[model samples]
Target: MSRTTKLATIASASAAAALALAVTATPALAWTAGNFTATLNGTMTIDAGVSASCTSSTLKGTIASDGTLSITSATVDGCGVTVTPKALPWSGKLDNGVATINGFAMDAIGCTYGGNLTGGFTGTDLPVTATFANQTVNRTSGLFCPASATITAKYDFAAS
Candidate 1:
């Protein structure tokens, strides 16, 4: 072969080798999930900021590969009270990353007496503890008294 032909052949071989390497070096898509500790921080305000205030607290829990999460014990403190009411039970459910609770009660020691409260939540959860923010609450007194008010709240969890 002529010198020019030999050089052309070498160049073609080099180009083919580079193309093969580029194809082989491509990365594959991967999905992985294991035990991990997650912390969620946000504000849980009531009535826009007139009733309650909370800071970025820690939420410790576990997450599985399938996104099935459960937290055993979580604590949140930054809760403020504005009325005197009988404290009620705090309970809720987490669905698809949303926190929904029926109610959470608080009393302001010597302000108004006992009343019933209802509220909703907005927050994020990574298959574990759900740390919510901007919870809105409405408190209504019994038939005879008929007093009502609104406030914010912050509570922890023992998710499972």
Candidate 2:
């Protein structure tokens, strides 16, 4: 073949190989926005000379693909009073089973106050149970002033 014909043949072969490689490469897995319901169950204590026990509750949210989540509601009722955030939905994100949460409102059952919470997770196994630890509960109650509770949340998902 002439030099130009040989060069053209080589270019065409290279292009075909590149196309084949691209078609065979694996695609990335994208997270989808889905409705999630998890039970937020944990412990809260006050170090008031003698440690006092406090009742705990949970909040739920919806997780989106773009790492956006929200708290739907919170329930804290054990003491003589009840405290709950008026907002039904809070927001946050989920990445690799670890959630960087935001817009969370926690209202103590006994005190007239609420706050934001941050926590880490183990992983999300649908219809299975997951555990969350190292939770930082920022309380905004005037009487209690402010407090943080080390919390562990156990979530059991309903079978899909």
Candidate 3:
């Protein structure tokens, strides 16, 4: 074969091998799109002084293959204090063992609080556990509202 033709053939083969390697090196997602429900494992703390041992809380959302969490609705029930989620749809992400909820706004106890919540998440199988310890939320309104609040809660998520 001609020297130029042999070089062209080698280049084509190297390019094909690199493409294959890239495709194989891509990582698989930990979670997928599905109907998921999260339950509070323990008490949910609001701010610094108020602690709400809510009986039940509901989280409705779907996780995309790209780790994006699209929360359609959420409810915190049985806290005696009315807890209302401000934004209809909340956006979050789960990646590298960390879970983050962006723009999480809520109204409770005649006060408004909104911020991002970031915490660790575990479990590759079913019933993933997300623990948010001392996640800070800033008071958006209400004179009596605490300037900052630390929230600690553990939530278990499972496909429903």
Candidate 4:
């Protein structure tokens, strides 16, 4: 074959190969908004010195666009053995964007998540810093048990 013909043939094959590769290339996986569950930690200042820490489970919510999450309505079990954590249909945000939970407000139940979460999504645990204020209790026992108890806790948000 002529030199020009050979060069042309090689170039054509290269172009074809490039085109095939491009056509078969997979696109990047984008992070989508979805539901997730998080574990809780820290402590709940019940009253005086009577308190309960984070439980095996705490909040369930959906992933927000900003890497935070919304607090789903559910009952949190294990509150000082005398009481179960109050179930709330709370609308809260976390991870800077899990559920300080940043700007989480619950006026009807009187609770809020505290602190400022920063950085991007890296599947880290968001600690819960909440104060459940003056929760009315009717427990017949416990040193810290009061008719009205305030719960202050800091839990972690583990993405699943």
Candidate 5:
């Protein structure tokens, strides 16, 4: 082969290798920093001896650039009982395909429960589903409250 032809082939091979390295070295951008909203996919049930099913619930929050989730407000309605979120801002982390919420506390009919919740995230992009199944919470107060309770719910999150 001609010397000029050999030089061109070598340069082309080097450029292809560099491109491949750049693609592999780039970090995955799983989540972005922006306002987000979470809506209940169905009924949210809390079982602590006495089962209560809430028809609807909404959560509003913001995700930082570093994938830190900050829930600013959350509201649950229906089931003939009022469910109130105690903590003003609950923090968590969204990484890989998992979602975790730390220090989640709620009150209902004088009873309060608090614990950490872990769930999985489904979806590649904007709208993702967060399903928390049988997350256990211990009673923080109230004589009538059970020692422990389980909460199950699926929430769909989207950018607002």
Candidate 6:
């Protein structure tokens, strides 16, 4: 074969190999009741900027046929401060790649409460931690935090 033909063949082969690698390197995602960890990150606007993070492991949850993850119950105890309201309900849509929850609850920031954890997700068995942005929350007499604040959240599902 001529040098030009050899170069073309090499280019085609390299292209094919690259394509194969791309397809094969794709990750596998699974959203189910497996070894998972939910992490909370960011700050709580109170008397001071309180750092917060809540991590839970091996939470029992369910995945619908459409890839909707229904986490029955999970506890996240890292509110930068000590308080009673620790755990919060968590739900998500694996198919749509969205983190969600139902009802109002106290959040990770010590006393100040009223924040919902929500973020985007991906396909595959808890490949990466999903981060939900901080939400606006109102204060109550219960936590002693009179002013409202915002909180961000991050969650990771343990591989199946």
Q: Count the backbone clashes (under 3 Å) in each candidate.
A: 5, 6, 0, 11, 0, 9
lDDT of 4 by residue, 89-156 (tens): 34444443222333332211233222222222333233323333333333333443343434455444
Quote each prediction's TM-score. Answer: 0.35, 0.58, 0.78, 0.40, 0.84, 0.50
lDDT of 6 by residue, 118-145 (tens): 6677655455556556665666434555
Query: In angstroms, how far off is 37's CA in candidate 3?
Result: 1.4
Candidate 4 structure lDDT: 0.45
- Counting only residues 3 or more apart in sequence or on different chains, how many pairs clash (N, Cα, C under 3 Å) in candidate 5? 0
Q: Rate the local accuracy (lDDT) of all candidates.
A: 0.42, 0.52, 0.80, 0.45, 0.88, 0.53
Q: Pick the winner on lDDT between candidates 3 and 5.
A: 5
Question: Using TM-score as the measure, what is the rank order of every candidate, best first?
Answer: 5, 3, 2, 6, 4, 1
Per-residue lDDT tens digits for candidate 2, residues 85-109, read 5655666655566555455454444
Greater-lDDT candidate between 2 and 4: 2
Candidate number achieving the greatest TM-score relative to the actual structure: 5
Q: Candidate 1 regions off by >4 Å?
A: 1-40, 48-51, 56-88, 109-133, 141-160
- On residues 1-160, what C-alpha lDDT tens digit does candidate 3 reach at each position? 9999999999999999999999989677666567777888877776647677667677778877666787887888787788898876888877878888888888887788888999999976446888888898898887777787777777887877
Error of 5 at 41 (Å): 0.4
**Cα error of candidate 6 at position 136, Å:** 2.3
**Per-residue alpha-carbon lDDT of candidate 5 for residues 25-56, written as tens digits (9 for 90 to 100):** 96776676899999999999998888999999
Local error of candidate 6 at 156, Å? 1.1
Scored by lDDT, the top model is 5
Candidate 6 — which pairs collide?
28-124, 29-124, 29-125, 30-124, 30-125, 35-158, 36-158, 79-108, 134-151
Cα lDDT tens digits, model 1, 15-75, are 9999999999955422134333434335544442234454433434444434433333334
TM-score of 5: 0.84
